[model samples]
Target: MSNKVILVVLDGLNYQVARDCMGYLNGLIEQKKATLYPIQCELPSMSRPLYECILTGVPPVLSGIVNNQIVRLSNEESIFSLAKSQGKVTAAAAYHWVSELYNRAPYDAVRDRFTDDETLNIQHGRFYHWDHYPDEALFLDAESLRQQFNPDFLLIHPMNIDDAGHKHGLDSRQYRNSARAADIYLSNYISTWVDAGYQVMVTSDHGMNDDLSHGGILPEEREVPLFVIGDTFTHAETTVKQTELCGLCCQLLGLEHCKPYAPEMIAL
Candidate 1:
């Protein structure tokens, strides 16, 4: 039998900010209702490349999606494709790049903004084009999709944190506020999702730097947070890798992992 999973990518969130600002998530950790694991993201720590890395379990060097400017459908097998091929439903409420990578290439906002075609890798989608799109709206969109489609695997990605980091720098008040706001919205929905038997993973594509940018060797650009809410995890102290997320998703959904993955990430 398959299980339901929701992966929430809080784009451009740095580990320090997440550890300090996401109060509700931290509350869960304090209450032992969730587990927090700080993991280093894949290089060059850019958004688009790490997006592919997180979903496909392939590094930028191997996937060739090394930068944010590379706009093309992914050549590697991804979580969405793997789920779809196994007769499972997949969905995402994320940045348009996700649609371009999996559903269609060269995304046309008018035609590709909202997709529900069963023929596509991402069978259902609610993609946003704006970097500053409100995170609450995106979560509501994801909740709406969950209520309607009940997809086996769902990707809920919000970009406001990344947007603030870009405009205000990592240490600015705006960036921290953005993280806090996202945590508040997550507090509203996570309990219902957990009660509904959905395994949820909230993490980031990459970190942000004090220079108001990313895609470099700085620890601020590479370190991000991972929070797991499910019964499958051991809750033990173990090292986790960013690329292992794909395999972990496959494990949650009862699908075979398509690429090499680190078993200790999930420790199932």
Candidate 2:
């Protein structure tokens, strides 16, 4: 595709929060020349399972990643491994447990375990913990990893918003504030990468309710946003609901041979 891609996941963030913070994100969207969508996440909508689905492009049934704390490994498949085989370098920066699940060669730079509070800051208008390992550290780490290994794909997960939402509620002022802060970081990150000529695909694994509870049968838990902006992709206002976002990623990367679960693939 001739474009490096970065996938940014804002944990537990909903459309409302993102829309409210659109002013911050819109600039990055314009700078990167990207598009936005409201994509659907899988049921239960927990972090580990949903992220696995996103990276592996397979559902829990096939990927064997059904929960947040468990690891499912089979000899035959892994998106990171497969991407490596295809000569694409892949890198990721995620919260503790999710990073462990995707430990593979091509996907480098997995962050060690950090508590939710340690990685996030809800006070002062919600910003990432820049004291220990700033957001720039992760971005620079990804950039360095890419420079050394030249990975074709990069995935980043920021957990402050999600953690705050879980502890407080999605409707809580804390959560919204966190979302706004996340938007600022995201915009800055996107601006930096897209300026470096990388296509940015921003999405989430799933959504959380106003009360910050998921893993249940609720539309709020399953609906998420999937937006793309880059030189390689087209821009359009389209909706892809209840569809597995993993498959969409595969399609965009021209790796559609990956097997996705039923109801995981939807057309916009």
Candidate 3:
């Protein structure tokens, strides 16, 4: 456990939504338990693009990821690849694209796929697409994996907030509640990792619009929230960009140095 790291992406949480609904996270920010940055995501502001951007430290235009429709990752030196090369185990519990991304990697990944009545067993804590709580299984699955595999790097992407946003739009009661629900679920996982001397980095892929839709570069859609917390985390006042996220994770996890996307934003 020399370089343990947990990266949690809350999918499509806007900065304002997180500030308003994620009370525990806010407490960390206010008390300086964590560093919070309102950072810039790429244009198009889609999950796939932002995910790739954060992983490769490359912009969407250069990485060839522009929207939800695209999934191919051209950048060879990803956080996953770097960790895997160093003999560090990596695991991810997330959306289908996660499987698509890790198809060839040695990483263990569980997708929050849509399930049927016969396939989904609530007694086993599994649910389906229409359940509105499909992501709860993700956290449970991740915990189980953590105990069994003892992975060095864990990436958890919860989808409930994204679902709620698309269905009811931002500023709706459902949207805010969904954000809170994600916060609650993430708190459990964060505590588990921190107790084991792991560093945690939480960020959003993109923000949302009035209709909770995101596909452009408007400030609301492009500004995502970032939080890095751990026992060894430095307390500093600095802003960061979405592309700089990969470097930040690498630095915190003691991995090979990846240059910051915005050199000016890094804290000395």
Candidate 4:
């Protein structure tokens, strides 16, 4: 692969909230340094299902990882698997669910929390088991991984926004503050990644609702944002789907996509 990619999944960040509260990202949009695409996530709008969807380009129904409780290793070809197969390095500083989905099952907190085995789908990992794990710390962990391994594909999944949304509803101050805080944290590393030739894509798995719960069809629970950074995109108007992200990652990392995706979403 000739290019590298960094995919940031800010769990439970709503499109509208991100548009309003993420000042740093919106500023980049105004300056034409980034592009924002408001995307409606797949049905059910839950974290686990959409996480699988984003990485594998498969819908919940087809993947059989339809719910959060259906925890098992994924069977489909993910960006990590594809990159690794091509002898590219892969890493993630994400929630333990990601470790469970890609590296091992049942998440042995003792052994699976911090892994650096090349045989695993996520070759280098720093897995956190709880939602309360600080977002700033996760970013630091991600940066450490990048500096150490220079992974070809890196997945950074932070859960503070979702944790805030779950504890206090989407309408609450905590949820909004969490998004803003994440934006601030992102400001610390995005330019460095871009300078180092990483195509950065900041997005969310799903959204949250006023009742402090999700898994329904409400707009508040489905619509999320995708921020495309670096020099690979065009200004043309485009519509993107949640499942299309996996293909986009493959395209950025110079890999052949296994699933159908709109090539118009990115420019070569």
lDDT of 3: 0.70
Q: Arrange candidates, best lDDT first.
A: 4, 1, 3, 2
Number of backbone collisions per candidate, in order?
0, 4, 0, 0
Instruction: Rank candidates by TM-score, best first.
Output: 4, 1, 3, 2
RMSD of each: 1.3, 7.7, 6.0, 1.1
Compared with the true structure, what per-residue lDDT tens digits does model 2 show for residues 1-268?
A: 5435677777777765676665666664666565567766775578767766676665655566677666543333445555555555566665544445544212233223321121211000111232234444555555555455454666677776777778777678877887777666666566667667676777777667766677765766776666666666656444554334544554545553554533322223
Q: Mind sharing the TM-score for model 4?
A: 0.98
Q: List the candidates' TM-scores in order.
A: 0.97, 0.75, 0.84, 0.98
Clashing pairs in 3: none
The segments of candidate 4 whose C-alpha lies over 4 angstroms from its true place after superposition are none
Candidate 4: worst-modelled 10 consecutive residues by lDDT: 257-266
TM-score of 3: 0.84
* lDDT (10s digit) by residue, model 4, range 129-171: 8899999999999999999999999999999999999999999
lDDT of 3 by residue, 212-259 (tens): 688887888887788877765555666677878777677655777654
- The residue pairs found clashing in candidate 2 are 34-229, 44-215, 89-151, 244-264
Q: Which parts of model 3 have CA positions greater than 4 angstroms off?
A: 104-133, 261-268
Which 10-residue window in model 2 sums to the lowest lDDT? 118-127
Tell me the whole-model lDDT of each prediction, alpha carbons only: 0.92, 0.58, 0.70, 0.92
